[model samples]
Target: MIAVRHIGPPRLTAGLEGAGRLDWDAHRRLHPEPAPLTCEGLVALAEEGRLHGRGGAAFPFARKVRAVAGSAARRRGRAVVVVNGTEGEPGSAKDKVLLRRAPHLVLDGAALAATALGAGEIVLGVADEGSAASLESAVAERGLAARARVVRLPERFITGEGGALVRGINGRRPIPPGRKVRAATRGVGGRPTLLSNAETYAQLAVLAGLGPRRYAGVGTPAEPGTVLLTVTGSARFPAVVETPAGAPLGHLLDLCGARAGEGVLVGGYHGAWITGEAAVRAGVSRAGLAAAGGTLGAGIVMPLGRGTCPLGECARVARYLAAESAGQCGPCRLGLPDIAGALAALAEGRDTGAAADTVRRAVRMAAGRGACSHPDGTGRFVLSALEVFAADVARHAAEGGCGRPVRGVLPAETAARLRLEVDWSRCDGHGLCADILRGLVRMDEYNYPVIPDEPIPARLEGDARRAVAACPGLALRLVPRS
Candidate 1:
């Protein structure tokens, strides 16, 4: 089970915070606070504290508010506030803990942002059942159900993206659209929407309650505030930690009972790998992580045990990321699978002739080609694996195996099984299915359709439906694997 560990004197996780999850009444007694601030006041406070988005992007919170306010000023309708709590990153669980333990605090922040941005409605999108239930109950207990609502989201990774969450809430497919559209300018219901992760909102609540000076008391001058980190995989406690922003990485690892020389994956699956004792010296802040050739993506710090095969672990996560693609763009759909295939061959250490080189080339081809940055993020992840695990790669190349079993320190989900079924009797060989979903259906020599033996992953369902709709004879259909 996951545990809660606080470091460097808790701020966001103040009184009534501990190992046990806090309920509504208990939370109310601990911190029943309010901050009545105008849009300018909120922006001023954020700018003073240098509040940054707790999500992977690390965008400035004040700039986001200004953008949303400016965008809403042009539109005739009101603005929208969305608290993104999807937490799709496999190794990250900090947002889930906040939503479960301190629902009221999150709502307070959302309500504050909503008032500042002229938004009458607050929408919270959650993936897990426990978070959803707790938030809904909190909204009702605080008598906020009228203006606040909870939306259940699909478990796919892409659904957690900002634009994708807006699309899902607006009743569209929860995939990043094929073009660039800033959610702050034009968002849900054609109005500007202020969207940020759950931790961002919780931090906002803290900043709102304690002004800028007190909020700046915990962290460094550059990043002055406490940040949440989900510490898992080889840590003795495997807990969600709240630590001061500039705390030494070594101290946090030691607190979690991690050894000094272990290989660490900071920032989740999409983050880079830092090896050996050097990982200990890096700071926990975004700027500090960047100096160490890593990121603070979603604040996930995963340590690989010595016994685990790093190559096999990388391959597993690569395959999982490949299957998580939204399947709308060619680079993410085609290139990720190519990278995954090459990594699988490398993991097996069998006939890996040019497979390593192929993996390197695939990463280059995949980067910066998708509508979303999933491809770019995946490329970075795999490229770092190669750099940090160079010795492992050489050993596997020479010996045809590492001889170490994959411990699956990184979590992955099996792709759902689906297949394209063709009714030959009804098929007129229109080739429409091939045109709509070339990845799943291709034209054969006889001008009929050809399908692969493997199953179509869940991410490809939208394309599958479009292909079925485009079929002239209604011959193309998708069926679950038997």
Candidate 2:
């Protein structure tokens, strides 16, 4: 179960100390409802606070507002406010924790944006049932059903991306388009849309409630506000934590009962690994994390303690990322699996030190080649692993192993299982499966079909079966995980 924890004075998570959802009345009692503000006022406050999206990108909130407002004004159309709650990054649960425990705050923030922009609608894209239910109940409480839509989007890695989430909201495939399309200019119903993650909206509400000066009371002048983070992996218990922006990373880890084994991964899967010394020196802000050689991407702090094989753990996550690709682009479609394959080879010491070089080459090839950044992110993950665990590379080279077992310290979601298997004995490298299931299957160097080892997405089950049927050699088959 998800729970809320805080490191310093809490701003976003105030009055939310337990797992129970704070009802509207209870929430109102605990924190004052935000005073009404005009668009200019909102933008001015955001600039003052230097407010940025709490989501992975840390994008400037003020710039987004201006962009949306300008686009809407140009078209003489109303803006659409989309609260992105589709938290797709595994090992992160801050959005879920907020939606479940403090739904009203999130709604209040969305409502604030809608009012400021004179938005046509407020669309909330949620992934989990609990978040949807909490939001729906909160919307009903505020009598906002007419103005707000709480949609349950596909719970996949890429589904939370701006274009993908917008597509899902528009009743299209919930994956990134083959090309770039900015959501600010064209979004729901082709109107200017002010889209940002749920925590961003909540932060806006906090800014409004406290005003600029009081909001600046919590964090540094540069990053003036608390940030929420999801602490997982080596922590004693998984938690969504509220921490001051410049708070020491070490304190946060200690508060969460973390044992920094094999160093700490400062961000999510896309984030790089930091040594324990860096972790102690690192601040929780984006600047702080960057200084420590990682982005504060998605605020996921994971660690691998002693006794675990770090390379093996990285290989496990690499495989998961390969399987979770939206399959919309070539880098994700083909390159991810290659990286995963190389990482596995290196981890298993299958091909000696050359596999490590292959992993590096694959990462470079995959970078900046996807419709989305999934490939780039995956590359970052594996490349960071190779850098942080160089000693493990030499050990495996000489000893053929790390001696320690993989403890599964990194998270790779596998709730549902769908496997695509190739029968090598009957197969003649027909490679039909590659053509049939473009997303799940790809052709290797020798024309043999390679499939992601993770479960097949439910949406692709039919395509998987078709590939099975179309295989001339009967080399491909799909089997459900029992």
Candidate 3:
């Protein structure tokens, strides 16, 4: 039986009360007696504590701070700080929780970072209105109106990316552009910027309070500090957890009431799949997870329930991610949907080899081909599913059916509502739609249009319109978004 533990303080737990709030001082106290912010000092403290980004990249805080400091000193330009509260990865709720419950902690971290980097301004960007309001109110209450500003951003999945957030702050659409743009070099009105996740800032606040030695005392030597994780899937308690880095995944699974038999999806929808609870023995640190061919992406640990078919779940998630694509890059815009469709075909037990081939080709084609890591992340997700669930693929291949329904394990309201209808009576098998919409609408071995699971992009507007116009059978019509 799975065991569950109701852990951590409640979301609205009082600010910095007792041991839990050791790092946080009341806004009034902190504001009135603001400490000097220094780059060398903060770097020494962070390096001593061995602080890392909690956003799952696990990039060293000292390195990132030093980069900004070095650049600022060289260029003779002031630095700017951005606290990213746009927790776009659906399953990761830790940042939102921190902003809502301990806004001051996040602010403190940002202030320390701003002072360290010699930043003139600090901006906190939030995805939801509630988080924005919470941060805004906290800033006002703390009398930090001059130092910090909170901006509410549209809640698109990719908008949470550092560069995208920077663009949105500069009055551009939240969509990622076609080229690479690092927020550190040019960001927030073309100033050098330091951006990190909200939880990262909070942890920095903790480091500031406890110093490096005290902070490193809790977690592993390699990655010393506590990390907040949002545990979901079949776990009984799906609350945000604050545990030491390098904690065993098994311990986390045990806390979440996860059963042993089912595979676990670490890192949320765009994360990897580990085959059993035994795989949970892998360390939760970034390097540790990466060594296991998985990542602690956004600190989301979702356990796939036993009853659900893993392949089906993967297809659903692939479809959702495809839809969420920024639609800028050619391969991601074209390839991901094909991959999703191929997975769907395999799930339905139709032309299994062909579907697998399509997925393989799409994965190869889409990897690292986007302005953001969305395609690469989604490709990793799909490839990990194939690796971890080899038996499921074989079963589908042999039986031409899985004997299980495709239960929606992935949370995508938009993709769930999208239906690709085939009017067999109208489909003359002319295959023109398949020809024109090559990436999205492909031909199955049997000559039917295999619509891959992804959002139709505006770039495909001309092609889709052409395909609809030229369909000899008049069987294809693009469905309007509801």
Model 3 lDDT tens row, 1-482? 11112233322223433322212355444423336557889888878887778785768888888888777777789999999999888777778877875788788789888987879999999988868877888888768899889988877677787778898989888877667776677788887889899988888887777667767776688887776778877676676777667778788778877763557778776788877744566887787777766788888888877777778878877867777777777766777777877888888787776777778888998887778888888888888888888888888888886677666655654322233445678997888887887656777668777765444555466777788789888887767555
TM-score for each predicted model, relative to the true structure: 0.88, 0.92, 0.88
Clash list (residue pairs), candidate 2: 261-304, 261-305, 418-455
In candidate 3, position 263 carries an lDDT of: 75
RMSD of each: 5.4, 2.8, 4.0
User: What is the clash tally of candidate 2?
Assistant: 3
- Model 2, 140-186: lDDT tens digits are 99898889989898888888888999999999989888888888899
What is the overall TM-score of model 1 with all chains considered together? 0.88
Clashing pairs in 1: none
lDDT on C-alpha atoms for all candidate structures: 0.83, 0.84, 0.75
Per-residue lDDT tens digits for candidate 1, residues 346-398, read: 87784466768989998988888898989888888898888888888888888
Ranking by lDDT: 2, 1, 3
| Winner of 1 and 2 under TM-score | 2
Clashing pairs in 3: 16-21
Give the TM-score ranking, best first.
2, 3, 1
